[model samples]
Target: MSKGKEMEGEDEIEDLCRNDSKHGSKKRLVARVGGSSSGEPQDADYSVVASLSDELALILARVPRSEYWKFTFVNKRFFSLLKSGELYKIRKEIGVKECSVFMLASGETSWWAFDRQFRSCKKLPILPSDVCFQTGDKESVCAGTHLIVSGKEFEGVVIWRYEFAANKWFKGPNMINPRCLFASATCGTCAFVAGGIGMETNWKVLNSAEKYNPETKSWEPLPGMHRKRKLCSGFCMDNKFYVIGGTNEEGKGLTCAEVFDEKKNDWDLIPNMLKDSPVSTSQSPPLVAVVNNELYSLEASSNELKVYLKGSNSWKNLGPVPVKADVARGWGVAFKSLGDELLVIGASSNSYAGHGMTICTCFPKPQADELHWRSLDKGCTNQMSHFILNCSVMGA
Candidate 1:
């Protein structure tokens, strides 16, 4: 019988877990036995179920990406126990944090907010078209009800606003500069966008930054990044915007790191990240977050998230990612913490050499040796491109 036909008779979904293996990783799924449809002897059925163990659950949890959601309907048991409660259980076991990712789908980008712990996610209709809108550099400020996204077609900027109470999207202000491949973030009720190459032949790398006031529905000039940049990563640390490594005009990586202080209305220098060999390398903009007054930079190259403690003035190497990740060569990477563990999303090349997004979440370990990376069951979607966390509802 085919695999589907064989599992059709199972009943009472138990637990499925992913087990670590010497060869790599495996899974084991366990379920309670139901009345046999085959009219077989009770003893024979008993033996089969006696063999079920936690190992089976672990292996089942590792269901291949192509088969993740399909396995949800394997039996009524799985739907109730694993599929519905899967996200929550995973979060509880490992201490999960809620986050989301915005991916370009159907010629536009949309955001998906997830309760990593519950595995329950809702799609936000606020879409990114030909607009220069994205999350701002402020760690505490997120794209709330108002956001604008830029598109490459005709320098068009589209603004999307979310009504949290009704859970819907409405129109907002348009951007003066319709930019693509830009970096942005939010701080103090203002959203700032910077560092995108204009469509002009000169392909101007922008150093100018613009701020959007949601209340006023207007754009104003903020202090610009010291370095002209495009396709760079920006984050808000300690209420200061940290502009890190990015490609130059000729598509060369930079080693410089700069910060913008909103209070002072000035840009200043921060520590520059360097590879072990001191060779200038463009480390993809880190998926960054602030916790316990420390700034953590998650780098794809190192597979490690380094934390900069403000008080100590040094980086604390916490632990490496849980699973092996092969993100695309040139695409940007983002890191955010859901609940307790850290989650990372990025784009990678498939066999066809097309870019696809990958999502992996890490669980906390008492010892650094305990860190593990587990790829989430990414349903049929373009490999994850870029994502952010919108905990606005949960926070309230």
Candidate 2:
């Protein structure tokens, strides 16, 4: 390609961010983090380039995505690279991926993405999804670089995807089945969703499953599950997809879990796997995550952390987690895998007074009795400090 911009401006952008000036506008303060006016120290200067050669794209991809807004504000050429998703594509080709947390707080109009350390955050553009979709429950999963969120609208279920490359949300590419309260998990470049309630007027429970391919921007039907389940949870372990702990069509909770075998292209039922734990309507889907191929669960009824024993198809308690998952019944909490650590964000069991939240992580092991949980940073201001309605981790 031909060189497009002059690539000569010396004007540098502000350093990453500043806490929302307690009194000023949160949006303006956040915007200044990228503009040239902030008094913060100079960010590592990246000169604007005309054509994004693979070498330059590699360098840009290496930069944390939290800093990308600065480039877009200063150079149109750089903006096109981001808007066209070329830079994101280059990042994937070189095996460059960063894990960040995306959360939507209760009463918040838009979603906010925070860097892994919670050092900075950026507000996303308002999703144009209908008002009904906004008020209803939604399921979110990250496939490749896209954050796909599905929920109910006025007439039916709708899917909206936030493309990291383009930095925008687009509607459609809906599931071939289009359902809600499904079990979803991210595996490599694709996302697998299964066992949800259908959109029919009678609201039938479903056992069907499908895979979303971000590269093709379409959903491909997968073989159906053995049981019709809704409000379930899904995870990936040992290169296989597992669905666990959801109510069946009878409106009774299920203890049996199922694993999808890629080699066999079918699901194998693991009976009475969750028989040890109690299930009720008050509880959310199993608060579970896999770190280093080992499964962990934060029992929502109690504040305890437990490890799954794959050999026995059982769970072993790892002692109490720092956060209070019981108060919300596992709802409004974030339980996800952050690289090799298990990340849990919620009200503190110590003394949770308001909508504010606290974060903690642990490198879990099977037999570790007293697993040390280290508190991580919480976001600034009440805007982010509110109850978390939805949270998902994206590795892009």
Q: Judging by lDDT against the true structure, name the best candidate.
A: 2
lDDT of 1 by residue, 318-337 (tens): 76654223243223444654
The 10-residue segment with the lowest total lDDT in model 2: 9-18
Candidate 1 deviant stretches above 4 angstroms: 1-111, 116-118, 125-141, 154-157, 161-166, 200-202, 274-284, 309-316, 330-334, 339-341, 346-396
lDDT of 2: 0.80
* Candidate 2 residue-wise lDDT at 126: 92
Error of 1 at 85 (Å): 30
State each model's CA lDDT, in order.
0.48, 0.80
Worst 10 residues of 1 by lDDT: 22-31
Query: Residue 137: error of model 1 in Å?
Result: 20
lDDT of 1 at 206: 76
RMSD of each: 14.8, 10.4
